[model samples]
Target chain A: MAKKQLPYVIGCDGGGTGCRVVLADAQGQVLARASGGPANATSDFALTITSLSAALAEAAAQTGLSPQALRASVAHFGLAGVVSPAVAAQVAAALPFDHITVTSDREVAVTGALGGADGVLLAIGTGTIVAAQRAGQRRDAGGWGLQLSDQASGGWLGRALLEQVLLCHDGLHPHSDLTRATLADFGAPLDMVLFAAQAQPADYARFAPQVIAAAQAGDAVGRGLMQRGAAYLDLALKAVGFMPDEVLCLTGGIGPHYAAYLAAPAQAAITAARGSGLDGALWLALATARGLRGGAA
Target chain B: MAKKQLPYVIGCDGGGTGCRVVLADAQGQVLARASGGPANATSDFALTITSLSAALAEAAAQTGLSPQALRASVAHFGLAGVVSPAVAAQVAAALPFDHITVTSDREVAVTGALGGADGVLLAIGTGTIVAAQRAGQRRDAGGWGLQLSDQASGGWLGRALLEQVLLCHDGLHPHSDLTRATLADFGAPLDMVLFAAQAQPADYARFAPQVIAAAQAGDAVGRGLMQRGAAYLDLALKAVGFMPDEVLCLTGGIGPHYAAYLAAPAQAAITAARGSGLDGALWLALATARGLRGGAA
Candidate 1:
């Protein structure tokens, strides 16, 4: 008689930028991985499902398993824009898996950053996500977006820089090299105003590099903005209950840039991430598989 | 043989809320006045034109002048959302008048507040407009809008209050009565985030009264917000060249509320507006008529 085939598991990490999936055996050894287009659940639910399906299919193919066969596997996903339980349920229902779990991308990022250990994850890009995980319990602060929160985010930095330029134009604040360079980008102050009138967070975030560069060069306005951002980050770290001994992993496009500005204690606590978000999803999938077996027994 | 009719002039003050037109004689004596619907030029140019024309026609009718005869009048308008000369030109082209000058509503407000004399106008509502007029040379600071500026305006206060609530929610800040009350209005923190995602400046400004009341009741968060707003206002005043001796007229929905917050010197310098924006428009209309006669000679 043929030997019984081992059960499979799937892990998915989805974000605004792209969707990623990995396939593994019951023992949790990686079998295959694949990537697809953007999969922000809130922005485009149907597109997220599509992207996830395509990436999962590719990973299944890599493991020499049919899509139908893969549907019987355990799975877990950490996705951007899963703002509520209803969204998480919708995402879970859309995917074909015998057992699955869905959660906000922040959770998986923290898990991946700390490798399932108790620590903090500060993921700052066009947005900010400050999260802490202890003994599998997790909590997050900030990452509310550019409109209300995301205080120390790249988007916040860029928008604050533009605001400084306008203040200089109004003579309320003295101009620095950063502010002057920012003003030069516009035909006039009104042009900048018009641009800001319709600018989205990402559009504003495009200016973040200039701010970072100016701050590194000791531009007063840029340094002020960075200091402000750092202050907010410090608050967030404390709010999340970051302990001195716990790992502090700074990840994402703009996260590590803040190292120079972080408090000495936080800097001392920093550690390199062991895995990506995909690894966190895989870790969760394995846990789900174990739970299913335990229940069966 | 027939006595020459005194040249007619039309003064129109168009704002986001409504349009007001005053039919006047060459000497700036108001004959008839009428009001119409909203006339924010940038938001709806065609609608603004319609509103202005309707108000002007009503005023002309009250003054016993035919619409055609009224079209020959010298007109001056201070309209909301006239951000550029091109917008002003477009507004002027759409109106039926022989001689007309179109400018930002700020200019007319400053003129009316000080009765065309040298002074400062602090107009704070959903937006903030700080303008100084010295010997007819006028300068302004702030009033860019809620996104880029409007630091001390109602919209800013309300938005800042919401931000404080979120900060409290994240455990990054202590919640005072104001923040707690604001949070209670939402189903949950997520609901507040959803609301902010789609909120306009007016929606945020609706919360200003709560902040003001809480501040009056000695809420720490509210008091801090008010103090921050007052500081920005002081900076704006300095930016616009507001002199200690100059008459500082507080106008608009939220302007006088800051009297308690302003510096003693600024409070001492405060004066009631001499006339409304319509009066300032009428003054400009008279100036236009005089210029027309002088050019003809």
Candidate 2:
């Protein structure tokens, strides 16, 4: 005889770039997926809520379940900029989930990357997310925003590139191909000075691709930056209790690019992520639903 | 025979710290001097104007001349944050000088350091000013601001120190006494993250003395930072056409501290500044008056 269907669950992964939502069953069976606009709670809470709601509604429609009906079951949201319990509480109040869990995007990313197992996560993009998970507990270092931390990130690479260009302009350092081209792109050092004054982290991250490509092609400055970034990553992984034999998932727009620069041990430990942050949210949602039903979570 | 006394001239040196005004004869003889509150135009334009006006009035009073009488004389202002022609124009329009020359503080600092002779100036403080003065013209490389440039400055040293502490916390590098003490000061790395988020260049500069002292004591991190800073200074000095035999005036609260870290040739070139920024302003004002009199300028 066929088994009875389980209650529907919802999971949402929100960030500055965009949002992803998943529809699934309490047993962790995926039903449908949906994408939405940017959902960074810290950047635009109202817009983030709208994006999440629309995406949840879309995923629910794909599974032929009303969002309200899914909300009655269980839901989990892993969102960027949810740095504190107060922020998570605010997000929970905004969403229409009856039984919902809200957490930082890093936690979900690590969960998805490691498939809920113990390992390390290096999510380096415009910002750096260095975290480790052990027995379902998560710990992180760095990612303290660009002004203080976020070292070895795309933003860090781009900012360092600009600084090098100015140094070359001053005749303190000779202009490598990377520095020369970068300075040329901005017209002059003064123009770069103007850009740096107002450029945000994302704005600086725009140069990461160039730096990555240059590093691959043996540009001294580019390779130097990648090496520096790799060194920081090595330190961060060790700080997070990353054993060389354990899975080390290097994920993000810029993370994979550093694979070539990683130490031999980290290179050996590198592994592809099992799933995405949305998947991790769905796993969490499934666990929440099972717990509420008095079943093994 | 004793030369006839020339008309009075005025010179003002205004910075974030405070403003100084000197009243002197066109022949460069000092008449009187006065001081006023902070006059950083970018920080508070109205207050800068007030500071300048009050200092000018006070100096005129000491010389037994009406403020209005001094306004008829030649005056030169070397001011911080006078980056553009528009800013200088605004300053000129606000002050009551019949003939006024407005320029960047860096220019006057170089003049004061070099005493109107061609040489290099290394002015490192919360900011870094690297300039080469030649035949009445000045060319500068850094001093773009703390955001992009200002390498080897007290601000840069302090910021790097904080970055090192974070790196150590992440297990990326070993901590020295400097980093350990620095981390202890904040109680925890998170506290430092909090402090750095709102720290200005000056705020970071507060840690420079500790780093300086630690380097003196042979603390590994402190020495590393000083060495790195000295490397940048070497490049800047070379870029500015600094020669082993040429005069190199290292001036500023943090400038002389770097003497021990400088290269052998740079150490050999070091010379005490002939005067101060205030004296440079006076020299420029006298020059302006002499030009007006159709005499040697």
Candidate 3:
């Protein structure tokens, strides 16, 4: 009798805030899933490796497989902070699978969004990054990290909210209902808001929703920030070679909610990705197991 | 006979990028001046304090006065990052003057422009901040630092340049003479440009002039950035209880350069400060030496 073929593949999307893992078969059917925290290899290399390992183990456990069994399988990880060779090697070493591949989260996101075809992908999560693909060539825009770039990400939005609050506090911007709501959410005498802003980029980014709420509620400054955010994203997408009619896949939380801000042309180009990082990872795993190949054209 | 009173007073404006000390007597006489680097008390406390001390000492030295003799008189400092009591105390201690007063660079600028009257002041330098004063009550806007805020600043303009370059690189934004000029200035191979942006906020900010040049050259995106920078500054100014007929004082390097962006009301409010940070500082010191007389109120 012929030996039974392994029926599952695994994928992981590791980010600054968390790591998500998905187990799927060759047909793109989800077999299991798991999550863990703070796995951005660039920011916290050891933690990222540990978290990726744990998340993969958890997903395998859910699928009724041992770590060794999972190690024999193929896997792919779309990870944040995989921009350098060292980071990629560290992350690859952390995964359980033998046939493992790593790429910038943005690249995998573009691939997942376009299904390995040519297109533009705008990812605006805690940070913002845009990737464009044309005839197998890839281009990137923004995602310069929180300090000097990532203009339209959740981090950017959150920073905008805090800035508005500071403006209101200092009497440089109007105090709107949204500002009050945001202050209340942050629990402030205003100094607390400053502390939050000074603490971390991610801290401010967490309040991006409140800013969106304020914009939704008709605060002009808030609205302006949202409009600019959308414009910045459009600019980023355009940077990656988007044109009048190309499909632009909107990924990340802000991408879907803020879709209305894109121009008709950009909106027409916008579509949701069928799969996320997990799916991309799973696809990589199955491809590896089947000896699927990409050629240098 | 009463000792001949010195007809002019000296004013020192200390900031993050540079320091300027202006000698103007009681009659607004401009006598002598000099400039140097990074004197923002909050961002670079020691350096700024040292620079301030040195600039003042140097100015006095040029006039044949010993540092201690200059210390016998009063001086005031309108400085960046002097917002906190500790910073204020630190700056106060560093100065050689018998009486020295410290206040936010914003307050002194407004006072200098408005002659201690109620008005709004928009200051845009490496960072942007607005301050408004009415009936002795003061409020602030923007100026959260380079990473998260400073909308209409030199820094903002510079970042816009980088954004444009990235856009061009990715084919999102169009390339123009401005883009070519900026890339050339930065010696761009794309990665070199990226490396420069990654190096420091100031490095990016230095390119702001390119955007200004582009605006001058009729690049829509470049023009839009300048206009938007002005608009953001206007929004902050407007938030400060602006009245249609009220005066608005525009100060700082970018502030004066982008004066065209201010709305009519904001423009009407716009006036050049008679004294800069140094004058403001002198005023504060004089007021303190005079025992908090009627001037501040």
The predicted structure with the larger TM-score, 2 or 3, is 2
Candidate number with the higher lDDT (2 or 3) = 2
Tens digits of per-residue lDDT for model 3, A1-297 = 775565467778776667898887756678788998766666567877888777777877788976677776667788876767776887777665577888878766766677778778887787776887888888788775665467778878877777677667666556887777767766753354346434454666777777777778887777888899888877666556679777787887676756878777888877768677666667667777676433311
The C-alpha lDDT values of all candidates are: 0.85, 0.82, 0.70
Interface RMSD (Å) of candidate 3: 3.8
Query: Residue B124 in candidate 2 has what lDDT?
Result: 79
What tens-digit string does per-residue lDDT give for candidate 1 at B1-297?
A: 775465798888776567888987777777898999767687568889989988877887787887777878898899877999999999999988877899988877777778768889888876778998888788889888778888988889999999999999999999998899899999588888888878766678889999888989999999999989999989988888777898999887778888899888898999899987778888878887888788866
Candidate 1, A259: how far from true, in Å? 1.7
TM-score of chain B of 1: 0.85
The all-Cα superposition gives candidate 3 an RMSD in Å to the true structure of 6.0
lDDT of 1 by residue, A125-202 (tens): 767889998898888899876788889887798899989998999999999988988898897988988888788666
For model 3 the local lDDT of residue B267 reads 72
lDDT of 3 by residue, B47-139 (tens): 786777667666766677655556655566777766567778888887766656666677667666666777777777777768777888887
CA lDDT of B235 in candidate 1? 90
User: Which stretches in model 2 have alpha-carbon errors above 4 Å?
Assistant: A1-75, A79-82, A86-100, A137-139, A293-297, B1-10, B14-73, B90-98, B137-139, B293-297
